[model samples]
Target: MNHFKQTVALKDVKCFALHGYYPEEQLTGNHFIVDLETEFSPIGFDDELGQTVNYEDLNSIILEEMKITQKLLETVLKNIISKVIRLYPFVEKIDVSIKKLNPPMPGQIGHSFVKLTYTPTN
Candidate 1:
């Protein structure tokens, strides 16, 4: 049997966090935007909740990671990817992008982001 993959994109997830390289950044939190895409085998296409990935669970994981982990966006992104792969074993690949709005850059108003892609090993 041949297995097909499905891609799901969760974009523009607004979060408030204090993840940065500078010391003062830790004290001052800023807005963040997260976009995630998870690729997995399609088990079913029914409209029922159980037929597909539970976004509620996914969102919870993302929120929990953002709240507890106060480090670089890269670390946070990697953490999220690890958690997702663990929780959803059927997932084959994933792409995560995290953006910081109103950052403490020299002249830019705000906007620092990172993107990561991962493929789990069998």
Candidate 2:
């Protein structure tokens, strides 16, 4: 029997965090939006929580990681992926994107975003 994969997504998670290269940006903090997607193989169809990843847990993970200050969005994405993989080992693939709202720049600009996709070898 072939087991089908399931996907769980959490999008537009709003957060206020101190993450930036500029010292003033870090001190003032900024609005951020996070999106996460996870793909995993289900063990069964018995309507059990253990069979799939919980979106609430994913939200919590994002919120928790956002609290820790980081200079780069790449670091933030990596941290989130690591935590997710650790908590849900069954997750084979993870896609994460983080957007920094109203970034500090010379000209008027919108948010800047970084996306990362991770696939565990094991």
Report backbone clashes per prediction: 0, 0
**lDDT of candidate 2 over 1-122, digit per residue (tens):** 77788899999999999999888988999999999999987777899988889999999999999999999999999999999999998788999999998898878778999999999774
Off by over 4 Å in 2: 1-3
Give stretches of model 1 more than 4 Å off.
Answer: 1-3
- Candidate with the greatest lDDT versus the true structure: 2
Displacement of residue 21 (Cα, Å) in model 1 is 1.6
Report residue 87 deviation for candidate 2 (angstroms): 0.7
lDDT score, candidate 2: 0.93
